[model samples]
Target: MERPYWVSLTSGYDRNEVLTDLMRQYGDDVWNFAFFLTRRFDAADDICQEVFIMAFKGLYSFRGESSVKSWLLTIARNKSLNYLKSAFIRKVTLLDKVIPRERASPSAEAVMFDRLESAELWDHVMQLPRKLKEVIILDYHYGMAIKEIAAMLQLSEGTVKSRMFRAKQRMSELLKEEREYGI
Candidate 1:
């Protein structure tokens, strides 16, 4: 029987090997979570890079109590919050004005089709309050268990459940309003 990759990585394994595997497996997830929290592409890139660096430096302290993905996401969430609080971040709004949005090519019909299909629901999800959005993304989009989410977010399981319920209620209300408006 083979041990799981993370199990081997945490059990006195080679540092480079463990770091490489961790980055390969969870890098995109960490980046996506950061993007969802920050809503800025550049910030997400910085957050993702910082997360891997922190994870590598703190690797020995990892107790294997949670899945590696959850641990990485916790780091990402903290870094994103810290970044949001920094004065340096406030000075960057000027750059937003200078950056031009990329235009999609006309040949990208599949991309357009997919966006049109999911954009409405995703837009509603994005409109949710930060806490509710985090819970919904972690639970539904990432398929994390409720217990894992509680551990990752440092919330009680009941709190996580309540947030999920509230998020669903809010989403339902948004959809109802859209329907009434014939949108």
Candidate 2:
């Protein structure tokens, strides 16, 4: 197969070319990950933009220790978690659940249906704690290897494996319970 566009352009490229390549290549993965972490479409949109903007601003400082994707994900993860923790967002999130937003045209129903299809297990995966959920997503959803997940989460390989095991076990139990009790 031919080498990808960004592979040749990894070094000594103009900022726009490099940034554009990175965004074009990894934009969906980063956005999906942000959405996985936050479960909010609007937050994912903001976090995706912030991830690329932060990547562009810090491009020069990138040491290439891990893959560029890993670095971008680390940034995305932090920004998403920070957004979740902000006091304003906490209140807004509560209000959002309690009070419905204005009924706009249903422009995003397609995206919602696609996401809901994956949660067809009745959102059992979504019920996993964030750490467990993220490992499952990175492993099963994104197909990252355990080593990569460990590095991204700053955990040891053993820890990543254990979490994966726990996530799988919990997911199985959740599914089993649902089947047995229709919960």
Q: Which candidate gets the maximum TM-score versus the true structure?
A: 2
Per-residue alpha-carbon lDDT of candidate 2 for residues 104-159, written as tens digits (9 for 90 to 100)? 56435336656675656537888999999989988887777899999999999999
Cα lDDT listed for each candidate:
0.83, 0.82
Error of 1 at 108 (Å): 13
- What is the alpha-carbon lDDT for the whole of candidate 1? 0.83
Model 1 per-residue lDDT at 109:
28
Q: Which of the numbered candidates is closest to the native, going by highest lDDT?
A: 1
User: Which tens-of-lDDT digit does each residue in 1-183 have in candidate 1?
Assistant: 112655435546787887887888788789888988887777888999999999888877877788888889999999999998888876675566687466456323235436676768877988999899999999987889999999999999999999999999999999999999976
TM-score to true structure, per model: 0.83, 0.86
Checking candidate 2 for backbone clashes, the offending pairs are: none
Instruction: Give stretches of model 2 more than 4 Å off.
Output: 1-12, 102-118
